[model samples]
Target: MPELPEVEIVKLNLEQALEPGDEVENIEFLSSKLRTQLCLPKDIRWPLSINKLERRSKYILLHFSGGFLLSHLGMTGSWRVEKKIKAQKHDHVIIRWKKGNFWIYNDPRRFGVFEFGVNTLTNKWLAKLGPEPLDKDFDTAAFLQSLKSSQRSIKVLLMDAKVIVGVGNIYACEALFRAKINPFVKARGLSSKKLELLLSSVKDILQTAIKKGGSTIDSFKNVSGEKGAYQKQHLVYGREGEKCVICSQVIRRKVQVGRSTFWCPRCQK
Candidate 1:
């Protein structure tokens, strides 16, 4: 899955590839949208010039000269930029620009979304997300305030989109491990100091993952078809029963909210 950092890279890559003055040569919609999805016309002519690329959480927003294109990679999807290549099976959406052809949205699982509208950047889909983990606004005080009334497990609380925007399953496990906090601890039971550690670890792990091109356990890559290099640096996620990298304890895994949670019993409380 493309987390916050991966989305950031995609935004940047799109921004650079589709330069500011580059106008849309043509737009095509591969699949039809159901009437119940509230989806507008999938195939339409869009007169748009690339303005700027912005990212919120895992969502990518392309601010055009007249409108916006919102895309969510969901899982098993990517926006690959290539000079030349044959379209693969999952290449659902494609955008042709002046500079080159950019393979926009490709998702084998088919959960990715591609929508176009005029100034719909602040739609309800993005407005509900919480503070981004790496942004300056995501302070320890703010984090604690968000969790002030929560009795859910710390892992579950962190995963809440209302609490923090983009800490996905992999980063959550790594962050909890780094903070030495048990994933099963109640959110309201954590002390201020522990919360501070958690906040810091969240930022640190996200930044590190972004720097490493984000995790690609299955099929994540940049718009350039390169696999992310972060998977090799994983410490605990998917390392169940292996010795913990920090305390030499066996890294344990359990299901919380239907997602696997990995932590070291000896290192994390």
Candidate 2:
């Protein structure tokens, strides 16, 4: 699944690949069985140019003159730029550009989103999301207060989208490891200072992940069909039983809330 960093990379790649005056020739849906049938608003003006691209959590928001295209790369989705007009096996949607290129949305699991709508900020999925970890609006004082009131384990709390968006399973593990905080520690049991450290770790890890083109755990790729190399840079998420890079202690992994949580027993205690 594409997490915050992966989604952000896709948004950035799209922003770079697409131009302001590059008009959309057509929006074609090759499949109707995504998480839901992706529907385009009927009132959209024809041949509109892309205005901008934005990412909220894991959703990519493509701005246009008439409206926006909102999509989520649920588990196995990706967008690839190609001049080939023919759709591949999992290519569910295609935005045919006027200049012979195509923005292809492919998903083998068919669990992704490719929908068009008029309003993005008012969309329910985006509207209910909490503050972005990298945004200035993620007030540290308020976050500390929230952490003090929650009984969930620190890693699980960090992964909660309602509490803070974009801290996915891999990132939560990596960030917790970076913060030297045990994954099983209760949110309420953590000190404000420790929580601050965790917050910083999350931001730094995510920004670094984006810089590395996001992790390619499964099917994530940039808009240009390039595979990400960040998975090779993971500290603990997939390094269970391996020597901890910092303290040389053996790394550990456990399933918490159905997701594998990784940390160093000695370094992250």
Candidate 3:
């Protein structure tokens, strides 16, 4: 699945490639089923012009003159810009522009979504999401206040979309490890100083991953079909049983909320 960094990369690429006046020449839905509540093909208004592209959390918000086109690249889904060549088997949605550009949505697992709405903030998925981790509004004081009421593990709290958006499992583990905070530590037990470190680590890890084009662990790829380079720079994630980079202690792996979490036991208290 594409996380915040990956989604932000897509938004940036689309913002550069798609102009304000670019018209939606055509939209083709090859698959009968889309992992969306609303029907995209029928709900989306035709003859729409592109306004801008934005990302909230992991969702891509394509703002058009008429309304918003929301997309969620679920597991194994990607958006690629290609020529007018033959469409592949997994190319479920194709958006052709008037200037001969083709934007193809390929999803092998068919878990991706394409929905239409008038307002993005009023949409079901975007409405309930918490503050974006990279946003300036995510202040340290407010963050500590929010953590005071939660008894969940700090790692789990970071991954909760209702508490903080876009801190996925990989980045959460990496950030926690970088902050020297154990993933299993309770949210309310964290000190203010530790929380500050965790916040900074989260932002740094996320920004660095975005700069490296995000982690291509398994099936993630950018709009240009290029693999990310951040996986090579991972500190603890996917390095279970390996020597810790800082303290030379062996890294460990454990399951939290049914997801695999990696950490350096000695480095991260």
Candidate 4:
């Protein structure tokens, strides 16, 4: 699945190619269903001009003059801007712009979504999401307060969308490793100093990953159909059984909350 950095990259690329006045000339849904959501093809108003593009958590929001287009790229899903070409087998949704450009949504697992509505921010998907980790509002004080009452594992807390959006498994492991904090520590057990370090590490890791176009662990790709390069810079993720770059100890992997977690036993305490 595409996480925050990946979704943000898609938004940036789409914004660069799309203008405020570029209208959606037509929409074609090659698949019968988009994940669990059902969007009637005729419900989409033709010639709908795009107003802006925004990303919250892992969801992409395409602001239109009348309403909004919400997209969630589930596992193995991606959005690409391409010229007229033969559509692939998994090309689920295609939106033709008036400028002759085509925005194609491809998902091999058929888990992506295409939802349309007005006042979308109040919807169930976006209503309860926590503060964007990259936003200025996600300060150390606020983050600490959010974790003050949680006894969950620090790594689990960090992955919670209600605590901080977009800190997926890979980034969570990398951030904890960079902060020299064990993923198994209780969230409330962290000291103020350690919380500060953890928060800073999270921000740094996420910003750096966004700059690198996110980590492509499996099938993640940018809007240009290119793989992300941040995976090569990972500190601990996917490096299990390998030597730790910092402490020379073997990087260990464990399953936490059913997600794989990587860390250096000697370096991360």
Candidate 5:
């Protein structure tokens, strides 16, 4: 699944492709399970231009003249700009412009979603999310306060969407490993110094991943249809049993909150 960086990139890509000045020629679903159940039927009506392309948490918000289109790029999902073409097998949703052609929202797993609602509900999906890790508001003090307020394990705490948005399992493991903190450590057990390192690591990892266009594990492609280069930069997420990049200690894997977490037992104390 695409995390914050990937989602933000998608928003930027979508905005560049479908700005307010552009006119929507059409909106259709090639194959959607929620054709009617999830989103309002493809109401390709006139006078509907994207007023803003925003992202809240991991959800992409497309504010339009009439309503909003919300998309969640679930696992194995991607949205990219392309010249309008015939619908492919898994092209769940297609949005066309008056001139440049179309954009495709393709998802093989069909786990991705497209929902429609009024602009007033933008907060609905973003409301419960915690501060963005890359935001200036997510400083050491704030992170410590948030973690001290919860007793969840550090790994689970990192995974909490209400604590911080977009730190998925992959990034969580990478961040924790980078910070040299044990994923199994209790949240409240972190010292101020360790907490500061953890917070800094989170920001650094996320920003670096974004700069690299996000990690492309599978079925992930940037708007240009190029796979992300960050996967090659990974240190621990999927390197179980491999030598740690820092200490040469063998990396280990464990289940935390039902998600795989990789770390170096020697380096990550």
Candidate 6:
């Protein structure tokens, strides 16, 4: 699935392809059955001009005059912009524009979400999302307090969407590795210095990821169909048994909450 940085890049790419005044020509569901269930309002009227695009957590929202279109790029879900769209076998949804352009959604696994409605703020999906980790509201003092309250391992705490949005398993592992903090250490047990390092690492990793267009672990592609380049710069996430970049210790892998976490045992210790 696309994490925060990936999702943010997707939003930016979509913004480049789509503009504020672009009129919606139509919305088509091509699949006979879903890779995932599609949620759309029954009375979706067409020709609604797009007002703006915003992202919350892992979701992409396109605000319109009457309502909004919320998209969740689940694992394998991607958007492609084309002047002349040659629809693929896995192309699930197509949002056509009046200007003869097409924004196509392709997801092989069909786990993505497309929810269209007017009640965006109160939507069930956006209700439980935590603070954006890069926001000033998620500053050091607040982050430290949250960490001190959670007994979960620091890695697990960082990965919790309710605690902080967009620190997915991959970035969580990378950030922890960068901070030289063991992933298995209890969150509340960390000293103030370590906690600050962890927070800074998280922001730095995410910002760098956004700049690199996010890590393409699997089949992730941007709106322009470009594979992410950040995976090439990965320090530890998938380098199990490899040498650490800093301490020369062996990189390791452990499963936490059903997701693989990679780190350097010696450096993080």
Q: In candidate 4, what are the lDDT values of residues 119-194, reduced to their tens digit?
A: 7658878888988888875666788988878879999999999999999998999989988889999989888898
Residue 146 lDDT in candidate 5:
87
The 10-residue segment with the lowest total lDDT in model 6: 32-41
- What overall lDDT goes with each candidate model? 0.79, 0.86, 0.85, 0.86, 0.79, 0.86
TM-score of 3: 0.95
Q: Per-residue lDDT of 39-154 in model 2, one digit per residue for the tens?
A: 66777777878887888889998888767888899899988888876567989988888877788999999889877767666777777787889997778888888788988889
Quote the lDDT for 254 in model 1.
96
RMSD of 2: 1.6
State candidate 1's TM-score: 0.91
TM-scores of the candidates in the order shown: 0.91, 0.94, 0.95, 0.95, 0.91, 0.95
Q: Give the CA lDDT, 0 to 100, for residue 107 in model 3.
A: 92
Residue 11 of model 3, lDDT score: 80
TM-score of 6: 0.95
Query: Considering only N, C-alpha and C atoms within 3 Å, which residue pairs clash in candidate 4?
Result: none
What candidate 5 gets wrong by more than 4 Å, as runs, is 32-38, 41-45, 119-124
Q: Give the TM-score of candidate 4.
A: 0.95
Residues 142-239 of candidate 3: C-alpha lDDT, one tens digit per residue: 77888878888999999999888999999999999889999998989989899999989999999999999999998888888898888898999899
Off by over 4 Å in 3: 41-44
Screening candidate 3 with a backbone cut-off below 3 angstroms (N, C-alpha, C), the clashing residue pairs are none
Name the lDDT value of residue 143 in candidate 2: 80
lDDT of 6 by residue, 114-182 (tens): 877687667888877778888866667877898899879998899888788999988999888888889
- Once fitted onto the true fold, the runs of candidate 1 whose alpha carbons sit more than 4 angstroms away are 33-45, 83-85, 118-122
Which wins on TM-score, candidate 1 or candidate 2? 2
